[model samples]
Target chain A: MYRISYKAFKFEAKDALLYRIDPRAKLFVALYSMTISIITFDLTTLILLTIYLMIYISLLGKILRKIMRNLLVLTPLIIIIFLANYLVTFNIITSLVPAVKLITLVLSMNIFFLTTSPDDFSLTLEKLGVPLTITLAFSLSLRFIIVLSKQLNEITEAQLSRGYTLDRGGLIQRIKNFIPILVPMIVLSIKRSIDIAETLEVRGFRTDVKHTPYHDLKTTRRDVVFTLSSIVSITIFYYPLQDILSLFIPL
Target chain B: MIEFRNVWFKYDEEGDFILRNINLTIKRGEVISILGDNGSGKTTLIKHMNGLLKPTKGDVYVDGENTRDKPISELSRKVAIVFQYPEKMFFSPSVEEELKATLKNFGLEGEELNNRLEEILEEFRLVDLRDRTPFSLSGGEQRRLSIAIALSWDPDYVILDEPTTGLDGYSRRDLTKTIEKVLAKNKTVVIVTHDLEYLFEFAPRVILLSRGAIVFQGSFKELLENEDVIMRNGLESPKISMLMKVVRRDGGGCGMRYSELLSVIIERLGCSEDV
Candidate 1:
């Protein structure tokens, strides 16, 4: 059974410096890293981004452990990506490149999510002029990950106890075996969604009304310094320093 | 027989133990009811019986074999678990197909499979709904189908986790009948439940757990006699039981059943002749 704690990627109320910084700054850092990760095929750049996020995570105190634990959940996808790439190119280093890029992307995004509460993240999106509906959807999705994973765990255990072997079948048969697992998951998801919709309706949840943030988010001097420094360093590295590093790294 | 030898478990390495020093023996052909409030390690305890979870500190032995050394699929052949939500396991196109899928998992096929399928469909009263999708069945029918699927493989031990949860009066009665049928087959039935009223009626071997520890384990009558253990564990006795206690405290005597309490009330009111 997968005993994944629901609090792995959740934001905790901590007295760390990361929590003091504005969610907007964290969002920018995450977005900037993701944009760079997507735009560049350079392994050195991705490695550098990974190293930068690692430093940022360490500065947030003991959150790196939780972030690493959550990353294990992505291991299967990483291996699949590596195998698909190696099958086509037959180059080990080239296969490693995409996997490293994916890791870097996850590292950056997880840092932002771990430090920002859903309400704060929602408010930050609203501050950036996004629609209220989209912001609420994003926030609710983050909260729903725990619920969905828990439901998935329960369904898997229920099936396993009925003597259903997940590993007995060939590729097609293995996929077919998941029908017993997936059908219940979908049914439960629909039921839960209906329950949630009814709950929200009863609580007077509406898009037409302007909803205020539960906690007022104010950008302190720390956020300004952190945001400006991140932008300046990223611009300097992406434009000039990246070329210098690429020469030495020989990607 | 199943045995837990000083078993202790926690889902996370750094987390608090969910089941602490749990040592109990479930003999063959006996009914065991695990009683606790929510999160009192009731479900976690039963999961160890089927090798779904291994003890973190001690050992659990199923029929003299260590659960830690056995795969869940192998142990599942000896133990069947019916989870609280029946819909969480239903996936086949039809009710009959769902039972067939479970039976096939245990290596049954051909004539034997057909016989087992027919038997389960008939036993659960699902013959009329055999061709219907499991999702199309009513709540009680879906519950019976889930139990039927679990019992399709003819496992030696059956675990029902919150079997009566979200069930109506008639559905609860149907579940009681199902439990009686399982016991009649000489299967060891273990139930994790909070339905004390139903427990009072069924009166199985009650094991009370409090904060991951077994506070009491005996017959249902013994549990009612010691109300302190029940209250200390954040549980309330059945209404009939509470009423009996109240009457006894007032120097009046009553039994732990509704009919007994009713007769006592009539006797105390001096209205036996009026009835």
Candidate 2:
């Protein structure tokens, strides 16, 4: 009931080789291209990078419509950034280039978060020797989001039964509407986290213990090759791929 | 035999003790039952059998092996606890795989694993559901699948806590018959139940618990003869056990099996003259 969207996200990523790709690989290509896109103010380059990101995220099995839907939520905020850039620099091309960079960077992160389950992603971080505290922070915060959404619904229902009109509130007013949802949810989640931690301990969860995953994540050779190829595509596009195409078209 | 000598347990340190200075023994080949009111710590005590919960003070031993001293995987080989709402025990996808996983966890995989799995699935009438997802099955089918997984591991001491909690009459009988079959295999079954109506018919011993401690640990017949004790504990005599009381004659007793009680009823009515 909580983040019911995760079900649809799971269905999308079930076919995602890019998601199925090693986390290191996704980090290497997606993060690196995004960094380059930020440094350059070339409008043509930003457009190319955006196309690359769309194709890359599409490899996660999402269609154009799905990607646009997610982007639509950010469109208004993105337009605000474009307007701010236009006023600050008064260079329309300059503002447009960074705006595209901004959009691509956010899209890359969306791809990362959407395709990966918190469990697998955390385990991936752990395997890479991330600090226990850092991994735990990510795990608990992300886990909290899914659980908090569920608690929000439960709290709303309970309050509605008691004659609270959580449904009738403006954006600022909703902040006040959150006293019931916020207090009980935080209190309940902390208590529940403690109880669940105890339960996991009883079932033998230890930071120091070296145990195989009950459901192991084993990657095939195809996953390996495809990930390597995506990283090369990003690097080559930053230099050789774009240059090679320029010699032919002179654009 | 299972023994708890001076057992003291609390769900947490500095918390009120759930079971205080408890002393109990279940002899080998004996059918022992546990009874209690709500919040009586019946489940807390049962979990101590397999080291799922450790005692804060003293010890719980299952067949001379101290529970806290062994790893769960090892202790599980000796004592299997079927929890209340048995269907929830399965975390596996399909019934066959769920049964297979327990056998595998006990290091019982391979042809012998496949063979034993088939045999138990057949015994539990779960062969038809061997490929079916367990969570999608009916409530009764789900319960049967849970028992089949527990038995598939082939543990010695089986501890069941309120296994019939949410079951209907038909499912309850189905579970009881499965327990009887386990008994026929000479396994020591420790049943923690509040309802003795069915257990008194199929299982002989009915251990009574009052406030986290055993008040009585003996036959159901002894329970009926002591109505003051039953009433004081807020219990009613099971109907079949009460019906058998009329034919006690001189030395006979109530709490006979359903078939035996039926025969006694017919004989008292002079309806058994033909047989």
TM-score of chain A of each: 0.74, 0.80
lDDT values of the candidates?
Answer: 0.84, 0.70
Judging by DockQ against the true structure, name the best candidate.
1
State the lDDT of candidate 1 residue by residue for A1-251, as single tens digits: 44545767456777787777888888887788788878878777777777777776777644788777767989999999999999999998888889989988888787577778888888898999899989988988888888888888888899889887777769999998788888988887888888988999999999898877668778888888988887777667666767888777777
Instruction: Please provide, for model 2 over B9-72, each residue's C-alpha lDDT reduced to its tens digit, 9 standing for 90 to 100.
Output: 8754445878877888887766777877777778888777776667888898988989778755
In candidate 2, stretches whose alpha carbon ends up further than 4 angstroms from where it belongs are: A1-251, B272-275
Tell me how many residue pairs clash in candidate 1: 0
DockQ, per model, reads 0.78, 0.01
Q: Cα RMSD to native, each candidate?
A: 4.5, 23.2
After superposing candidate 1, which stretches have Cα over 4 Å from the reference? Answer: A1-8, A31-53, A69-107, A225-251, B243-275
Candidate 2 Cα deviation (angstroms), residue A159: 36
Q: Ten consecutive residues with minimal summed lDDT in candidate 1 chain A?
A: A1-10
Q: For model 1, which pairs clash?
A: none
In Å, residue B265's CA in model 1 sits off its true spot by 8.7
